[model samples]
Target chain A: MIDFSNPLHLLAYGVMAAGLAFDLVGCIGLVRLPDVYNRLQAGTKCVTLGTCLLLLGVLLRFGFGSMGWKALLCLWFIAMTSPTAAHAIARAAHRAGYALWKGSVGDRYAEDDEGRNIQPAAAADRPKEA
Target chain B: MTALDVLMLGLALGVFLCLYRALRGPTPADRAVSVDILGVLMVGFCAVMTVATGKDLYMIVGLAWASLAFVGSLALAKFLEGRSFDD
Candidate 1:
């Protein structure tokens, strides 16, 4: 029942195009970035933005319908969950003793997670200097 | 240019970039995230493609695909976290 020639269709498509552009840039950043933290930032933010745009497009194209409402709901769920998952993964990596890239300029978590300071592997293996 | 066509081209380029990252990522987590993101891009692509081609029925499939991506990401994140996070 939706009208293809409606002005909303044009607007929807335009939003979708913009979203895709942002998603492309995010992927480029993901490839270029040095480590997980940086990549997570890029991937989470860009995909969220891109998908939102796409969902808007679909909603408009379909008008008020089941698929349209479902698409919007999916978009909402993604927006809520993706970043939370990213943060959880990053936290686990830190807790598991995965070292960050040496070239990383700053680290707030370094101060917060003092347990990481224990030199379990290298210090344990080396003979005493005395 | 028609809006749908332009959006389709743009999304196609985006998907290509996501695939590039998925293939080239240095670590397992990085690759997983890239792949997850790619799945999202695919869902979007399908939706846009359906609209562009006047195939309205495919919209439901696209929604399913997008929802599956969330579950996929959650699983991968748990896998990446391994034992400690679960504890």
Candidate 2:
């Protein structure tokens, strides 16, 4: 139900719709994806982007005077922390020896467990150009 | 219900869905991931409340909740790693 009369309303609704779409997609991916690493990837990236967009819409609607600055703060806080938590979770999972999905292509983590460098196998295999 | 109400309903549904995943997830890491998502959902819920109620304080609640959730998730991940920094 879009109201074409007011541009602000239209913009707010559109942004909220996009955010909800991302949220739904991320949740579905979390449920459907195999393995811890894959779930983490889906949940972290999609939710962060979705929530940020959702808050941005709120900020725009409410204007920076009231809900606006608070929305900005929440968005920034989530952006800073979500990825760090995701990295921590993934690293912890790998450290705890959580099994990768059977269809996983390769394991740079397997090759370099402690150092946690996630380069492709070919990079390690190829000779230096020099 | 208005758009904000609808959004809140959807967020609540998402929370329940994630809770199921957290409960039924096989491994510790799986639960941890879902739980982290739950914290984000908490923030969403608070934000919606702020909008619907017109209380800027709810947004502040959401902010404080977000950071606390992050700390909790970090601790959970550490626990999953078996170091039990949570303890």
Candidate 3:
């Protein structure tokens, strides 16, 4: 049983609760979002933060013991990797010709590709060299 | 029930939601995204288990899981891009 009288334990409980809520909300978004990109946006950001917070709670609970050090290490690993993975997935999806949702506003990657292939328009868009 | 128990139950529910998305997603990318999220959620579960069991091993497991998940996601992305792995 956790000692609720300890300030650290209380803090750990609060942090863990917040992390749990975030995880649930992120998963809900994953299920309910309209498109792949939308789901990726929601799931990656929220879940990464949630998991990091959960690890932080563990660190708080254990202080500077071995468990706490390991929790902190895990926290760093997840934080570094999650967003990079999300970006890679998004880029791959786009390159694989996955269509954006009908309500999507812009595709910078497509625009860049077009500019690269059609130099005249790209040149025209650029300022004239004096 | 203690807060840890509630936390574990909520995380389990979240895992189910992720599983639903992974299983029923309309596109491969959606499935991939859900799988990535599932990996992250598992790390959280490991953390909770560490606290519940008062063990350090779960944290090590979470660390290894995070690394492997990242590699798997990157490989999936490369496969989706239709590119050679070396590229």
Please tell me which predicted candidate would have the highest TM-score against the true structure. Answer: 3
Error of 3 at A54 (Å): 0.2
Question: Candidate 3 A-chain TM?
Answer: 0.86
| Model 3 pairs whose backbones collide | none
> TM-score (0 to 1) for chain A, all models?
0.80, 0.82, 0.86
lDDT of 1 by residue, A73-127 (tens): 7677667766776676666555544556667655566544446664423233334
Ranking of all candidate structures by their DockQ, best first: 3, 2, 1
Q: In model 3, which regions exceed 4 Å deviation? A: A117-130
Question: What's the TM-score of chain B for every model shown?
Answer: 0.79, 0.91, 0.95
- Alpha-carbon TM-score of each model against the true structure: 0.78, 0.87, 0.92
Q: What is the TM-score of chain B in candidate 1?
A: 0.79
Worst lDDT run of 10 residues, candidate 3 chain B, spans B78-87
The Cα error of candidate 3 at residue B2, in Å, is: 1.8
Candidate 3 chain A worst ten-residue window by lDDT: A120-129
Q: Per-residue lDDT for A90 in model 3?
A: 92
In terms of lDDT, which candidate is strongest? 3
Please give, for residues B1-87, the per-residue lDDT of candidate 3 as tens digits. 987899999999999999999889889999999999999999999999999999998998998999999999999999987888998
Give the Å shift of residue A8 in candidate 1. 1.6
Give the CAPRI rating of model 3: high
DockQ scores for all the models shown? Answer: 0.47, 0.61, 0.91
Q: With candidate 3 superimposed using the best TM-score fit, by how many Å does residue A97's alpha carbon deviate from the native?
A: 0.8
Write the residue-wise lDDT of candidate 2 on B1-87 in tens digits: 778878877777777778888999998888999989988877877776776787898888889989998998999888877785636
